[model samples]
Target: MSNSLELPSYLEKSAAVSERFKKLHRRPVKLKVEDLSKKFETPKGELVALNQINLEIHRREFITVIGPSGCGKTTLIRILAGLDFPTSGKVKLEGKKMEGPGAERGMVFQDYTLFPWLSVKKNVMFGLEIKGLGSQKAEAEAMEWLEIVGLAKFAEAYPGQLSGGMKQRVAIARSLANRPEILFLDEPFGALDAQTRASMQAYLLKIWQNVDVTVLFVTHDLDEAVYLSDRILVLRANPGEIDELIEVPVPRPRDPGQFLTPEFLATKKRLEELIRPPELAQNEEIPMIRLTEVGDEVE
Candidate 1:
């Protein structure tokens, strides 16, 4: 519960981060999925969530999966994160078959998964503790991550004492403390108020810049995806499929003002078309363009 961050004496170099930026220039794929398909059988009937979904997540890639409700965005990310098995096809990490969840994979859920009774530091150390790290090591590592997320000062605070944004930040610190090779975010900020959501988005962008962990974020927010992701995977509903893989042209350490720029507007408009089909397009309204920067506006 101390405000001190007890990280390792030596900072761990994120090889994952290094590879991500390297591949950006070379454009090499890091994770590959070959014809991935998934289905579910319920008491009601058979449900086809994803079909013939093929894609590659490059190293250190900030890829956002955006789609309408019922699209297989969540299902796809679950499979990639090793939380679910695909009915068909295969997924490989750096060409090795992915069997299940490991230290290499970490998840941040929409709901705050923190143990309410546990203080913030304890919650952040939970994953490391599960990995069998010693108490001193685990506490130190947890504090370091909490510090990175600007929550070291709240180490003794419980989840109930924190706001939605702060809770999510703790979740992020917990996920990052172990230095996972890839981080899966299932609408991590979806529950926050608009102002808080924007603030978290900016905070996340800064973290993505500072760290090398690969991120597969799922959300229905086009602007959020455009603002944070290096590349985006657009999925369509009714038997989910990878309809398009659009690359955001803007550079890293992004400008929050980019949202107001003509280029950003154009990209958001294009994403709407991909996310919305003919019928839905009629009722779809343009998302509000609130162009304000919060926190570290860089990236």
Candidate 2:
């Protein structure tokens, strides 16, 4: 008599995903957030953006933050990246307290931030030059990063000459050329079209796999969160706080095909539930004004 039990298909996929990232757990904590909170003085009074948020990002891990609007997703990343100060608590990187913006951290915003006057390679070399590296050395390192992002051929091109995705690739190469320990991306692909965005996501994974930097991405796209993250940090709105830190149950070396898999679909479903408001989740009806003729309604 066999006593072995068959697990559901989703569970099988989940188990595989877990096994795939088990080694990541063994890695040291790269970024640690403790009792972090932020508050703003508004016309209505004090508004809390983040409340007592705590997190530990593992070395070389890709982490994404997602939540409803005004959930402090941007605020959280800004604080972590040293672009903004937290009202309380501390953020540490590799056991050292982070005080201010430094070369060790890189950031990419949603908008293209390339300098119009500089060529692609020059854009990448800007930071290196600021760090006091010789022009030849900086240019050499910049070209190397461009090659890694598959944009070496575009080195001589201007920002205006490149596509949305290409500009982002240049931005990434620019950030990476600094050899930062962590890269903060605040919806870097938000400005791209759907097809371009998908390709950018794939390109990002390829870059992350090759680079040693840890990724902290802020996004509104649930699919992007599930696709890119080793774990997705879901924040709650109205005095933002950590709701759940989900370990994505989709195996790595990810591809577009996996989007339809049981595990991927299951994970995405959970995200929708968490991020969607209760009213929406319950499918509550909203009063609608009739603008067309009664029989004119189209299914």
Candidate 3:
């Protein structure tokens, strides 16, 4: 069995308890996105990045955002993380309108944003230290998160010494140690190779199970979206709009072999259909007229 099964019993409690937790998490609507739209004005005209994205992410749920390259997945995540602003609509966290970056929201980018100068422990502790948690407390919290992500042994190692996967583990630990209610991951594993990417996906699922954080993950891989998401949000380009939201019915503690199963294949096929172009899989990519890179709307 995988280490996912080695977790403490509490993570494998009754389905009833899980249902109750889901209800509790969904009740307050941990994160609410309504009528969210973002556009960038350019010399030719306005470039619409995201259009009318409405979503409700429950607490502690793992939500994956999927679409083609220019479908506004990254743009939407940036807005949700408060790193960028939406041109129209609002996002609320715990019923409070989110304005700018705060400790309550943490982000892990595709690039290893770890401080090359700082040791893994220090990198994880840096955020807490900035929030004035002090050296002693920050170290303790950082260690805990590092351990949660299975990087405690490498605490003293520098970022340059770690592999791509280990670097990403440290990044996740750094974000999670802050105890943020919402964690936004922007293709954090996109840089890894196939083998490492698969391993990291399972590692992330294990870590997410252990933590009390809600996740909004953006990915270009259909298999990844199907494997990790509780509910996958599919978007289409050309003004980047929501196409559909699909639920994955596979049970928890899924392993790599599960991918070969019929249910998993079915889900993956459905997702492929959602994002694939007809010229290839379904339909042609919607043409974006005057949608050049000059707008900085990020396609």
The better candidate by TM-score, 1 or 3, is 3
Name the weakest run of 10 consecutive residues (lDDT summed) in model 1: 4-13
Quick one: best lDDT, which candidate?
2
Colliding residue pairs in candidate 2: none
Error of 1 at 247 (Å): 0.8
Model 3, range 1-299, lDDT digits (tens) per residue? 13322222212435654675566455557899999999999899999999999999887788899998999999999999999999999999988999999889999999989999999999999989999997998999899988888889999999999999999999999998888999999999999999999999999998888777889999998889878887789999978999988766556676877776565666776777678876545457876677455776645
**Residue by residue across 185-242, what tens digits does model 1's lDDT show?**
9999898999999999999989988998888999988889989987788888878987
- What's model 1's overall lDDT? 0.84
For each candidate, what TM-score against the reference? 0.83, 0.90, 0.85
Ranked by TM-score from best down, the candidates are 2, 3, 1
User: Model 2 has how many clashing residue pairs?
Assistant: 0
Measured over all alpha carbons after superposition, the RMSD of each candidate to the real structure, in angstroms, is 12.9, 4.8, 10.9
Screening candidate 3 with a backbone cut-off below 3 angstroms (N, C-alpha, C), the clashing residue pairs are 277-282, 277-283, 278-282, 278-283
Question: Each candidate: what lDDT?
Answer: 0.84, 0.90, 0.86
